[model samples]
Target: MKILIVEDEPELLKVMSVFLEREQYVVERATDYASGLSKIANYTYDCILLDVMLPGGSGISLLRALRDMGKLDSVIVVSAKDAVEDKVQGLELGADDYLAKPFHLSELLARIKTVIRRNNQHREQALEFKNVKLFPEDRKLLVNELEVCLNRKEYDLFYYFMIRPGKLVPKTALAEAVWGDSADQADSLDFIYSQIKNLRKKLKDSHAEIDFQAVYGIGYKLM
Candidate 1:
């Protein structure tokens, strides 16, 4: 999963980034309100860790802006402010959870997982599309109850497609969703084609009922 950490304290920011990265999350950081706003406006994330007191503005304002833009990304307000009003304001403005400073990294991880689960209430432990089933917790895929092994990238790509079955997914969006911010550095989308090819072969070999159809020069749609 990918997360955005909006914090001004350099040490805390670095510590959170390292801890979350070690836990296998793709971590992105912003030092202040402006940078955080820019990142949220341009990209999507599974979760956002927001610090209330920021250089340019309050994290409350950023949360308000996010809601104004109709972005429902799960937000956890991580701040030193433990005041009741602060917490109330954050919750009222759409933050999914709040964590005060001096908390354990393990606790933060637990809260992150909880908020993400709440945000994705529509998706259960196992995601099903046609005859294929994806166990996200185990990173396992099965067709007709038979396991179909896939590498990390292949699984990520296939899962991305599975969630949006029958919908056309643009190449750039797919790359960003699976590869995170690093996808911006790619010169072309040839890598997506290669990944799709491998996933297609795997699905076909497994006799899966669904398939991905290329959209000529645009993208692909899972059908």
Candidate 2:
């Protein structure tokens, strides 16, 4: 899964990034309000760790902006200001949870997992499409109660698809979401094609009812 940390404290940011990376998450960082807003506007994340006091603005403003944009990305406000009103304001603005500074990294991990689990469950049957089931927290996939083991890239690819279901997903969006900033340097989308081919075969082997319908020169839609 991916997480965005909007924090200005260099040490705290580094520690959090290193710890989350060790836990096998794709971590992205923004030091201040502008970059945070830009990323929130352009990308989708499993969760966001928002610092209440930002370099250029208040994290409350960012949270409001996110909800205003109608994006449901999970947010956990991590800040030194642990006043009752601060927590209340953050939650009222749609933050999923709040953590004060001086928190244990392990506690943060647990909170992240909790929020993500809650978000996925709230996403209508844990993002099920037909007979297929995807457990994002476990990185597990099931078809007809049979488990299908996928490589890292394949899981990432299908996760994106499972979330969107029948909707057409652009290839560029897929690359950016799955491969992050590295997708911008790709010479071609051949890698995406390869991943899709593998996932399709796996689904067929597992007797999954869903299949990918490629839109020539465009992207793919689950059919």
Candidate 3:
């Protein structure tokens, strides 16, 4: 998962980045309001950790701007101002959660997980697609009460397909999501095809009827 942190305090920002990265999340940081807003405008994050006091402007203004632009679902206000009204105002503006300045990194991580859980409508800790059950948190895939062992890319490919069931997914899209940012630099998408082939064979061997349909001109659809 990807997260954006908007904080001005260098030490706190660094600590948070390290903590979140340790938890296996992609972390991006912005020191002030302008940079934060620019990042929000450009990238999609699972959640945002926004500091109220910024170098260029107030976090409340940033929250307001996010709301104005329909990004209310992606922000959580983190600030030193712990007034009752400040909390209330931030909540009313659609911040998913609020954490005071002095907080445990664990607590912040938990909040991010909670926000992501709340946003995911069709997924639980155990992701269910048709008859297949994928425990993303546990990296386990089960079909018809049977456990199926999968390699990292195989698991990721399965999870991605479950996340967007019934929709055709392109080979490049799968590569970019499952692989690192360097997926764009790959010489061929043959590796993706190979992964798909292995994943499908495993599912079929398990008696799972999940279909990875090739769309000919487009991509594969998880049916």
Candidate 4:
């Protein structure tokens, strides 16, 4: 899972990042509202940890902005303000969950899990595409009930493909989605081709009833 932590408190931010990383989450940090907003604009996250107070702007305003952008289901409010009014406002403004200060980290983790479980459209931890199953939490792929070990890039390729089943994904789009800004200077498309090749091999080996096709003058399509 990917989580964005938008807390200005240095100590608390570090602690939260350490704990969540240990739990196998890809944790990203943003110390202030603008930084957090940039992250929200650029990347897709499974969840966001937002603070009410920040150096430049209030978390409430940030949440409101995200809500306007139709991102309410992806945010959790974490604040030191424990007032009833604050909690009500956050919930009303579209926070999935609220965690007050001085709470246990374990409690926060559990709350994250609960919010994700409630918000998940798939109804489970595993996402299904035809005959393949991709488990986001475990980072595992299974076909016909048999596990298929995959390399890092191969796993990422299949994950994106499954999420966009039957869709044509351009090589540049996939490169940018996976490598972010670094893909701007990518000299060759060989790396992406190699990963796709490996992913196709693994799926076929596992007896997956899916086909990865190269579209002429385009990119790839999972069918």
Candidate 5:
């Protein structure tokens, strides 16, 4: 899972990043509101740890902008002990959870899991197309009841395609989903075509009933 920690405290941010990394989450950090907003605007995450007080602006403002953009990333507002009103307002603005400072990291971790789990409950349903069966929770894929070995990028590409079924997925969208914020810095999106090419070969070798078909100068669709 990917998580963004929007905190200003140097120590707390480092501690949170290290702990979450040990727990196997990909973590990113932003120390102030401007950077936090930029991160959310450019990329997506499974959850965001937002601090109520930021150097440049209020984290509550960032939260509002995030929701205003129609981004549904699960958010947990982090605030100081006396900032009760901020916490309340954050919840009103659609924050999934909240934590007061001087809080237990364990409790914070629990809340993160709770919110992410609640949000992703709908994805628990296995996705199947033709002979391919994908179990999202298990991160496993099978074709004709046989496991299909896939590298990390290949699996990510396949999952993105499987979720939309026959819908055309633009290369830019694919890059953003797979590469996250790094997509913005990429010289070109040709890397996406290469990743898709490899994934297609794997599925074809496995006799997958569904295939990714290119629509010259446009994108690709599963058919």
Candidate 6:
């Protein structure tokens, strides 16, 4: 899973990023409104932790901008302001949940999971593609009704492909999704090649019905 934390508090931002990274999530941080808006404009995330009060602009306005773009990334308003009106405005603008300041990290994590689950409810708890089944919450995969053991990166890569079955997934996008913002600093996509090679071998060895087909000078597509 990938998460973006739009917070101005240095300590809190570090804490949230560290905790979510420990939970196996690719976490990106934006300290103020401008940077947060830029991230919203450029990248995508499974969930966004937005702080209502920001240095350059209000998070409420940022929320409005997100709605205008029609991006349905699950958002949780993390603000010091606990006013009912504020909550109403945020919910009205399309926030999935709200977390007040001085909150427990455990509760924040729980809320993040809940919001993501709710957003993906249409797909149910498990994602299915041909004979492959992936339980996101449990981080498990099954093929032909038998469990397939996958390491963390393998599962993340396969899950990304599973959700967008048959769609062309660019190598850059795949790297960013699995490796997070740091992927941009890499000199080459050799690491991605290594992971994909192993993933393809595993799928073939398991006799899976679906497979990844390279798109020639582009990327791969699950077919």
Task: Give lDDT tens digits, candidate 1, residues 1-223.
Answer: 7799999999999999999877767789899999999989988888999999999999999999999999999999877745677789999999999998889999999999899878975569988988999987678999999999998788878877777789999998888877787687799989999999999899999999989999998899999
lDDT for predicted candidate 6 compared with the true structure: 0.89
For model 4, how does the per-residue alpha-carbon lDDT over 7-50 read when each residue is reduced to its tens digit?
99899999999998778666878998888777777666678898
| Candidate 3 per-residue C-alpha lDDT over 17-103 given as tens digits, one digit per residue, 9 for 90 to 100 | 998877766677889889878877655567889888899898888889888887645678887755667678889999988888699
**What do the candidate models score in CA lDDT, each in turn?**
0.88, 0.88, 0.80, 0.80, 0.85, 0.89
Residue 139, candidate 5: Cα error in Å is 1.5
Residue 108 C-alpha lDDT in model 3: 88
Q: What's the lDDT for residue 102 in model 6?
A: 86
- List all candidate RMSDs to the true structure: 1.8, 2.3, 3.3, 3.0, 2.9, 1.5
- Report how far residue 126 has shifted in candidate 1, in Å: 1.3
Give me the overall lDDT of model 2.
0.88
TM, every model: 0.92, 0.87, 0.78, 0.81, 0.82, 0.94
Candidate 4's TM-score reads: 0.81
Model 2: per-residue Cα lDDT at residue 76: 98
Question: Which residue runs does candidate 5 get wrong by more than 4 Å?
Answer: 18-27, 81-83, 100-110
Residue 100 displacement (Å), model 6? 1.2
Model 5 clash number: 0
Positional deviation of residue 162's Cα in model 4 after best superposition, in angstroms = 2.3
Query: After aligning candidate 5 to the native by TM-score, how far in Å is the CA of 1 from where it should be?
Result: 5.3
* Model 6: worst 10 consecutive residues (lDDT sum): 78-87
Q: Report how far off residue 93 is in candidate 4 (Å).
A: 0.9
Off by over 4 Å in 4: 151-157, 170-191, 215-219
Model 1 residue 31 distance off true place after TM-score fit, in angstroms:
1.1
Model 2 Cα lDDT, one tens digit per residue, 1-223: 7899999999999999999988877788999999999989988888999998898898899999999999999999987745677789999999999998889999999999999888874455456888999887778999998899998778888988987888999998888878775575788988899999999999999999999999999899997
> Who is ahead in TM-score, 3 or 4?
4
